[model samples]
Target: MKALEPIDRTQRAQVVALTGKYIEQASRIFLRHFVMLPVFFDLSGRLAGMYKVHGRTRCIRYNPWLFARYYEENLAVTVPHEVSHYLTDTIHGRRGIRPHGKEWREIMALFGADDQVIADFDLSGIPGRSYQTEDYRCACRSHRLTHIRHNRIRRGWRYYCKSCNTELRR
Candidate 1:
């Protein structure tokens, strides 16, 4: 790996824990000669699938629930796909340019991860339960709503809108 700064021991341990669990599941289908590196998994709005940051960490922003739903059956390949990035980065040092170039893709294939399958997934498209409400509209006006549960509403008082008298959609 490039001479990048090391991550905190605790953070590295957490990554190992998650990586080990994924590896245990993946080893049955792929090679098991790799180790997890410490990296930050920044869950932001601008991510496309998983990526490596600072040459040490793998960052993926998929929703835990949605990811489990999609990859629960083949979790190992997905994990290896991400690890392949780490491996490729280390081998090439800082000279690595293309994110999913030929070398990285080859590494993924070696680890039994299908590049096509990983490419088919639009990681950003996975639906996550919104803790923030989507925009709502009534008449000519539109506004955002709270994400409170339906059970939290107190009877008939819930239907009336604070902006206008428009009865809101549930």
Candidate 2:
């Protein structure tokens, strides 16, 4: 395993402090409606934010850099949007419903947030492939190669078209 560079302790402390402030503010806003509200700031997941079902927990899964990258105006709205998910969960009993639904949207509006929370990160289309795969059909003309075996084949083994005599990449 590769050794990692040490993190700046002061910067880590600052990030923790800022996250604590957000969690505290969110807790206060939701406490009136909820019997208990637990807010957590997670750094590991790709999810920007999620409300855990039945737990009444609102989680903001964003890197510490987001605090500096996004404006306070946007954070103010996003923080509440995630909180509203918790509120909706509490009200509706966390049943079969879309993650973001009509009930959640109304709650977000009532919380004095924007019509939509501007994300600090991308929630765009799915990630694209870096390289063409042998699993996929070859792009070369005259000879189209179809993958045969599911198992890995040995290198230097011929993958040529017997009909066209075109060599295919392994």
Candidate 3:
């Protein structure tokens, strides 16, 4: 199969416009004006979209590669998914509700979108980064910890094996 091209400028514009449209709808539905969060197409890997908050900053990120392959589905589902996250956070404080709890589902229903949490898409040709893994052992089995996890362990964090209920160690 030929490698699929990333989303073009026109598609990017459509995504931004759709995001704005959803924000407008959510404001009307909730009877409060919701700020327009920034939209970015810098995500990769299997995930389709993400709603992220860093301190006072908030933004929605999309995988351009996934959008190129599943344009319509991403437009219909991914847009609403991220928008719902934004609205949920805006209405209910972030720490007060679960990420996919009832409040989020209610918002999704109000938006007339499926409440399914994750996008299931084949990522055969998507460009992804490879992480170095470290080997660790538990009582029952060996495990491969990604570089991120290994660094956390180095910084006094601990991980456990589910089956053996033992701490993972180098």
lDDT of each: 0.51, 0.50, 0.93
Pairs clashing within candidate 2: none
lDDT of 2 by residue, 67-129 (tens): 333335335655566666756776675678666788888776766677564454642332222
Question: Which ten contiguous residues of candidate 1 have the minimum total lDDT?
Answer: 40-49
* All-Cα superposition RMSD per candidate: 13.5, 9.1, 3.2
Task: Give the better candidate number (2 or 3) by lDDT.
Answer: 3
Off by over 4 Å in 2: 1-36, 44-47, 54-62, 117-170
Candidate numbers, best TM-score first, in rank order: 3, 2, 1
Better-scoring candidate (lDDT), 1 or 2: 1
For model 1, residues 1-170, the per-residue Cα lDDT tens digits are 33223234554455446556544544544455545444343333322236456444545432233333344332445456666666666566547557778877877776666775433344454443366665556654776666553334434445546777786554
TM of each candidate vs. truth: 0.43, 0.47, 0.81
* Ten contiguous residues minimizing lDDT sum, candidate 3: 24-33
- Model 2 residue 32 CA deviation (Å) reads 6.0
Candidate 3 lDDT, tens digit per residue, 23-134? Answer: 9998787788999989999998888999999999999999999999999999999999999999888889899699999999998899899999877889999977788999
After superposition, the stretches of candidate 1 with alpha carbons farther than 4 Å from their true spots are 1-18, 21-35, 38-49, 55-62, 73-76, 117-170
Best by TM-score: 3
**Residue-pair clashes per candidate, as listed?**
1, 0, 0
